[model samples]
Target: MMNIKVAPPYAEDKVLEIIDAFGHSGKTYWKKRNTIKVFEVGNDKWNVKSFQVPHLINRFAYKYVRKSKARRSFEHAEILLGKGILTPKPIGYVEYSQPIGLTNSFYISQNLSYDFDFGDVIDKEFPDRENILNQFTEFTYQLHENDIHHFDHSKGNTLMNKKSSGQYDFYLIDLNRMKFEEMTYEKRIDNFNRLSLTADMIEIVGKKYASLIGQDEAKVIDDIKKSCEKFKEFARRKGRWKKRIGL
Candidate 1:
């Protein structure tokens, strides 16, 4: 069986046709575990992400107990937009299922034209680096104040574009893993742990965030530093395990 959902202003029939032709046509934008492709219908471009099939246990859970990633991504995008957060416009999601479990799924959205992502800021010598980092801290503060916790709040997930008014606009991507509720102080601080920021960059963000929330800047920076250290250790351990298993 197959399930499909399409948002308004985009005809269901056309979207379905695009989905059906997903693997055969379209330009491959990114490919790894999951694949993202760009498809054009008339003048508009649609970014379609084809989620990797789950393992046996997850397949059953997705079919019977939990929502598929595609569905979650679509729903989360809507919620973010409603809360005045900038994300790509969600188009829809599609899922294919068998008697035992869900087999494949896809999430669709409008392709955003952006200059760079947060990763680029760290890796390259970009103009207005400090200003962009400060603005990003404010953007993240807004997310926390709105009670939105993005689980995968890592580099590359945030796309940045410079506006004509001499300011920057930030857009969030990878909406599948998110939590919407009141955020605790620990959770809020831990959110920055996944970002690959240097010590100086961390200080900039922590100071800005502390000022926004009326917290002690030194304590905030210390806590963020601790969290980043812990995450780094965890990543190192995980990498060692993967290497041990010859993965």
Candidate 2:
């Protein structure tokens, strides 16, 4: 069976037709763990991300227990929009499943063209690196204030567009892995661990976030550095385990 959910303003029939044609002629964005494609409908562009097929256990879980990734992405985008958080406009999602479990799923959202992502800023020296970093720090602080916890808060998930020299607007992607709840100081600082590749970047963000939150910059820097180390160790171990299991 197939299940679909669409935005109120959009016609489900047209959206489904576009999604159907997506299999034939959409522009391929990237293909790794998942296949992402971009489709044009009139003057607007939409992104449709087709998730990797789940393993046996996951298939059953997604079918019966937990929500499918595509569904979660659609719901999370709606939540972000309601909270005034910046994210892509969720167009819809579709899930295809068999009697025993889910086989495939697709998440649709408006395609956002941006100037750069946080990853680019980290790897390359931008025109106004420090100022942009400071503004980005403010943006993260705003997320925390609103109780938005993004699990994969890594550099690649954040898209940055500069409205002016000192002004920037940030939009988040990969919305399925998120939590909405009150956060402690430690949890907030730890959120920065996945964001920066260099210790210098972490320190810069920590100092700026600390200044905004009325915390000591030294302590914030130390805590974030430690968190970064812990996260790295955990990821390394996970990678090794995956290799050992031939996954």
Candidate with best TM-score: 1
lDDT per residue for candidate 1 within 1-247, as digits (tens), equals 9988888978888878988999899999999999999999789999999999999888898889999999999999999999999999999999999988999999999999999999988854778888899999999989999999999999889999998756999999999999998988999999999998889888999999899989999999999999999999999999999999998
User: What is the per-residue lDDT of model 2 for residues 3-116, given as tens digits with 9 covering 90 to 100?
Assistant: 999998878897788778877889999999999999988899999999999999999999999999999999999998898889989999999999889999999999999999
Q: Once superposed on the true structure, which residue ranges of model 2 sit more than 4 Å away at CA?
A: none
TM-score versus the correct structure, for each prediction: 0.98, 0.95
* Clash tally for model 1: 0
Q: Looking at model 1, report the run of 10 residues with the lowest lDDT sum.
A: 120-129
